[model samples]
Target: MTTDSSDLSQVDEEAKLDLTQQIRDAILGGEFAPHQRLIEADISARFDATRAAVRTALLNLTGEGLVERLPNRGARVRAISVDEAVEIVEVRIGLESLCARKAAVNITDADIEELRGVRAQIEAAVASGHLVEYARLNQEMDRRIRDIGGHETATRLLERLRAQSARHQFRLAFHPGRASQSAPEHIAIIDAVLARDPDAAEAATRAHLEGIVDVLRHLD
Candidate 1:
């Protein structure tokens, strides 16, 4: 039964979403590194799809600013400049502050529990020095907060910025002692959210974002 379902999905390309997702997964999985040029032919060959499909996928990634399309150079993974990094950090602060504030009013007990589960896992990952797990859990926490906040516009804006900001953030965040510093900030934000204090949640979340900014200053 599982084989049949998987077989049926093989030819499903009506939406083009699967193709886009595969490309994104490839990028996120570290198959492609920052500033690595994407050869359309190679990608098409890998996916067993047409050049058109590959081009479409590239265009979508470009639109999201995750891939840069240069006139002569073609597409490469986007790289963030220090200036861009600062801007992204600023935008993240505002978006997450909004998320924390809105979440105070709308968060359910189940949502709170889900956040706690994510937080616990993040803490464990930090303790074990598991950078990959830590990054994933960090993203999950951000996503949960955005979802619970009920601020669609702010969430969408943050999502777009994050797509481009990831390389810089990943570099800035996983520094030797940085994960340990970050874990408690997550706890503080969650504490404020659990208390249903919008002001406290907003402040706590902003403080957390600023903490990252401070660490980023020390990056090589």
Candidate 2:
């Protein structure tokens, strides 16, 4: 029995995509530090993929702005500077505020309950000094708002921007007193959406992200 060439091609593409996502997750999860070199052989061995596959995966991540390729230096996780992080958050402020408005108009009873649960968890995490958990739940809340808003284009753009800005965000998450400051902002967003107040939701979302830009500007 002969395997079809098209079938083999599809399998290869799937494997490459899987490998790319694994490396992307590692970078986003902080397993790979910003600007750290990604050696092809080491990555190949670590991920149990071929050098060629690792190379392709790195290229894909580079396109996604999660990795960078240098002349004669291979690739490394891209480092987003404070200025760039602020710019990214500025862009997010517009997009996320739009999402908040749309989500306020589009949210249902079930979505409201779901977001309330996440908000409660975030409050609990903050009250207990679990900053990491609070950070993660904050992301969860953003994702839920996007889903509820149902803006595919905005969601796609935000996903890429979020990945590119992950390291800076991770730093902000652990900054002194950041969680305490941000928890109320996040809760305000949720409250506005649950209240179905589109104007207030948009205002709350903009305030939340604008605060991040302020902090990014002041980051040492």
Candidate 3:
């Protein structure tokens, strides 16, 4: 991808996000292993970008806790940890529970409809045996919940945690039968939200995440 090409232009609003996302994709896709040092010269070569551009991308990921910067060293992909994974879910529960509560108060009819549509997409992905689609829709469901909730701070908090958890979650999702169960849990959470029941929505969201934590714990 050419740096100045419209598809990868750094001047556009999406350019910066794409750069960070590219780096993230590489790490989470296992193109770079845990604690793998990412030299600016090397990443610049890989991404076909200037050292400065690669630096900016590395800094962004470092801020998200996906990359670590040593005092004299550049950056490296962060290693996963069971303790960190558990804490991440605990933090997500707090933020997502708030989103579920706010979604009950603030979601519109159309938003609820869209959520149902998202659930349907997930079902289709499952039936088609596409785990990738299942994961994408799973993220979308959580995203729409936060969007409908309109809780910016809470959404940002959960989003960061989700990003951090992705490295571990991918492992769990790839495990046999886990991703299949995720869609149903997603639907139940949305069902509670669509019913406009804050209590039920909160409960369902909590249950959904706790279920995920169970699997992550099993990994440990």
Best by the lDDT measure: 2
Best by TM-score: 2
How do the residues 1-220 of candidate 3 rate in per-residue lDDT, one tens digit apiece? 3355764454643665677889898888889999899999988888877787788888889899999999898789998697889889988988898899999889898997898899789889888988887878878888888899999998878878888888787777678898678778877888888899999999988998898888888885
lDDT of each: 0.83, 0.93, 0.84
Which should have the higher lDDT, number 1 or number 2?
2
**lDDT (tens digit, per residue) of candidate 1 on 24-115:** 87876678987999998999898888888888889988888878898988899886776777778888898899899999889998988988
TM-score of each: 0.87, 0.94, 0.88
Candidates in descending lDDT order: 2, 3, 1
Residue 106 in candidate 2 has what lDDT?
99
In model 1, state the lDDT of residue 144: 86
Quote the lDDT for 69 in model 2. 92
Residues 1-220 of candidate 2 have per-residue lDDT tens digits of: 9999999999999999999999999998889988899999999999999988898999999989999999999999888889998999999998999999999999999998999999899999999998888888988999999999999999999999998998899899999988889999999999999999999999999998999999999999
True lDDT of residue 32, candidate 1: 91
Cα error of candidate 1 at position 51, Å = 1.2
lDDT of 3 at 160: 80
